[model samples]
Target: MTTTRDKLEMVLARLAARAEDERVFMGLYPEAARAAADAADDRRLAGVSLGPLDGMLVSIKDLFDVAGEVTTAGSIVLRDAPPAAKDAAIVSRLRQAGAVILGKTGMVEFAFSGLGLNPNYGTPGNAVDPARIPGGSSSGAGVSVAEGTSEIAIGSDTGGSVRIPAAFNGVVGFKPTARRVPLDGAFPLAPSLDSIGPLARNVQHCALADAVMAGEEPHILDPYPLAGLRIGVPRGRLFAETEGMVEIAFEKTLGLLGRTGARIVDHDIDDLLRAMREATLHASIAAIEAAEIHADWLTTRAEDIDPRVHHWLVRSSAVPAHIYLRMMRRRRSLIEAMDRRLAVVDVLALPTTAITAPLMAPLEADEVLYNDADRLILRNTQMANQFDLTSVSLPLPHCERPVGLMLVARHGSDRRLLEIAAGIEALLAS
Candidate 1:
């Protein structure tokens, strides 16, 4: 039997061998992790187990509070900020579950962009192709899982942070309904849309971590039967601008599901999506809310912030309070409309991202390119956040580059969505 200590040692050694420029992790807790792993090994020897996550190597995004460490949120502006007085709620929960936390992973600045390029902390390259972008702001979280540095990685998804990285890195990422997991200790990007989730090698690991973080009892996942399952495909604007490979893979998967006793139907939501898009023409809810969170810093430390992040924050700060309120009210009604629309299907299926990870050089060198890619990368995943739903990104098999098939469910249907994802995962594996 491979002991937890063995796994921890292997991970630590691999991390040690990396070049200093590889910024997959912001910090590492070797001594602490060793202690935890040894403790877990001892428990196993004595025929005791804390839970499914016991002895697992876990990594947390930099935005999550780690007692006595400053939560940088992938920006340098907060480097001098006071250290957190205590660990974040999820961190405490993971520790209680006997998870051996490796360290804090890297993220996009302020969790604002999904491109994963962090000039402040060197960007962590994609696990599959080092030159390509490792989707973010949970870039390091996804890479850690893909590269085997962490068995599970916890990340916050405001607008596809968790799922985007998972898609690019070829792993499983789950974004529970916004409020399903407590947000008390996470740094806010958009308080109303922020959700804490996990990126791991498989759906079951995500489900286990999600339940633990949500303060719920973890249970065995019985893969929901794929036969007779109703999967709705919202095929309009969301399908536009997709890469050729992504489209081919998605269509093939749909065909396979259809042949396997699943019912695939066209479920149009373009009107609702269009309205939501028009409402945010000036600024997104995430940007507007983030602007408030960083208002003080925006004025005093603008130079310290990432230019891409600063630009959006500046634009969002200009949004009038009444307009923000009006958008909020309209958003609630749209959420209701979406929930009603989803009642006809078991879940919604779409490509997690429109394209696979693009090369980092082009995006980094050209601001225009960066902006366009960022918008497209975040486009589909943001829908769930805006409409208030639960979603997961499952990596597609046999793709040269990783592509994710996203499954979205109604609000508060996190467990059911995970169960369904597990079934699809097994089907694809077969």
Candidate 2:
């Protein structure tokens, strides 16, 4: 068996090669990681391995608190914030499961946007295509995994942060139901919408990390048979702006699933999109909640925050109390409607995003360009967040550019969703 130290040394060398590259890690803990790996090796020698993750290396998003380190959440504004007295709940879980914490990876400031652009820390180039974006706000987390810096990278998803990067980098990202894993020390983007998950090279990797993070025993995942499975394809604007490569790959995936005895059913989800769109116009839940979280910081350190992010907070702060409440009420009503619609299908399959990763140059040069791309990138993935559902983004190998085939399941169906995701993953590989 390969020793943990050997694997960890490889990871450290990788990080060192990119040491000056601020986009990947906000912090590195080689000393601690080496110590942890030594312990893991000792345990293995004694034949007392903790579990599947024992001796494995994983990276944490900067948004998560690592005991004795400040949680920057991708902004320099919090550089002086008090060091966390304890690890984030998930961090604690990962430690208990024997994962050597590699370091805290970069992110979009406060986990706000789908495009991982950070003015404070340079944006991490996409592992698949550096010229293009690696989706955010879990930008570095995905790259860390895609580049083999870590076996898995832990990240939070409010609106596609984890999934977008995973999709762009040609890896797997799983966003479980918001409540399945605790989010105690993760810096909030949108509290209600923020959910922690993992990005890895495959579905099984994500599943295993998820099990550990959920503080549950690592259990074997039996393949979920695709035969007779009811997969719903939402019919309407969800696919409107899909780029050619993404469209081709998604269609091909559907065809493959159909061949595997899966039933493809079209469900009209016009109302679902309509409701989410309306919510966007009048009540931005992310903005509202984010505004509250940063009220004090915005008042004092407005200049320190990213201008684009600050602008969002300004609008969020302006939301009238009534409008926010109305949006919340509408969200509940829409969730009920979505549950009824989804009951007919085992999983809702669609393109993770309408377009694959766009060039970062044009986006940076033009705010209008950035705005348009951001909206489109978040469009489909936001649906999962809005409805409080569990979702996974599986990479499409045949696409010219990386594209994610997103599978969404009803709220609280995380296990079922992951099982279906694993089955689809196995089918795709075959």
Candidate 3:
């Protein structure tokens, strides 16, 4: 007899079978998934499963090291790297908890850029509109989940890599406070700001993935009630450049969040405009790290790297020591101010992306990524990094264009944020 577990596994098999042509996976290790899934089915049949996510399939960003696979970070330069001796810390935890490692997904080279484009690997098409881009460096991970290739997708967020694509695809993306997820096995982007998180079809899945990535017990928290919840509305730099429909979709989301009985308050912070400069920080940091990691290969095999990433590294190598240190220090001060403001609300709500995904064909034709690309992609997401907040991007309904209504809370408040998101998700779906 085909069990309920068999039905889900069949769905996954069909999804994974088409994974390659989707341009979403950097590489899918099907043998690994099959073996793991078969074992998982046995456990499920025996009624000895580990957790609710036991049988779930997880798609990982290429930046994460998986045993027997090179950690490419979507770069050709690492094509010769030795197969990883061990899985990254997060991957190990997910596996131990019974989540099948579906495959490695494509990402921006070196996980440097915000817009998910890889000249070498070919960018994954956004689910909403194939003509558009999938936000990166967690690009493929986003598409994998949104397209149902995986039950959940794990990715790293430097500035907005995780949230941008989540917003673009109308899925739930969560970037827990930077320090929450251990970064030992993943390729580094920005040591100070990089965090591993997840994208799921809904908030509950995201919450489960967050716990596994963070090495916490994966228990779903009670849903949030907006009745007495104080939600902060941004009044400064955060809303500086609102896209036409984005503004409409965001306002509509707020109205819904407000109608749920949450106490909405506006907050003013002139200093946020200053944080705008941090958009370049992750790229600069990633570039420096990339150069350090690829130093030897770079000297002789530079052309092997995607040109856009090579250029980003060259620019990053030029960052002065004092400037880098100042940016690092600035992050702390910004976090303090952000926390002070959040003291007034259970969560801060805003649009996750300033605009919808832009056309990729033109940029592909030009053989160059645009200059303003990162700015637009990193614009809204930088705040969570700036303030070191735990954030989730929830999808909105009633619009032809999908929007992510972002909800952010203070550091260590990830659990609460997920709970709040569950309520918001239920409301949106209803």
Q: What is the TM-score of each candidate against the true structure?
A: 0.99, 0.98, 0.92
| Residue 428, model 3: Cα distance from true site in angstroms | 1.2
Model 2: ten consecutive residues of lowest lDDT: 14-23
The candidate with the higher lDDT, 1 or 2, is 1
TM-score: the better of candidates 1 and 3: 1
Summarize candidate 3's per-residue lDDT along 113-144 as a digit string, tens digits. 77788888788889888788888889988887
Assess each prediction's global lDDT (C-alpha) against the native: 0.95, 0.89, 0.80
Stretches of candidate 1 above 4 Å error?
none
lDDT per residue for candidate 2 within 1-430, as digits (tens), equals 7898999998888778767765788889999999999999999999898898898899999999988988889888899999999999999999989999979899999888999999898999999889989889999998889888989999999988889999999999999998789988888888889999999998888988998888777876777899999999986888887898988898889999999899998988987788777876854788899998899888789889998889889877988888888888888888899989899899999999999899999999999889899989998998899999999999988777888999999988888888899899999888
Model 2 residue runs over 4 Å out of place are none
Cα lDDT for residue 417, candidate 3: 90
Clashes of each: 0, 0, 1
Please name the candidate that would achieve the greatest TM-score relative to the true structure: 1
TM-score of 1: 0.99
Q: Report the error of model 1 at residue 49, Å.
A: 1.0
RMSD of each: 0.7, 1.1, 2.5
lDDT of 1 by residue, 1-430 (tens): 8999999998888888884766999999899999999999999999999999999999999998989889999999999999999999999999999999989999999999998999988999999999999999999999999999999999999999999999999999999999999888899999989999999999999999999999999988999998899999999999999999999999999988998899999999999999998888779999999999999999899899999999999999999999999999999999999999999999999999999999999999999999999999999999999999999999999998999999999999999999999999999999
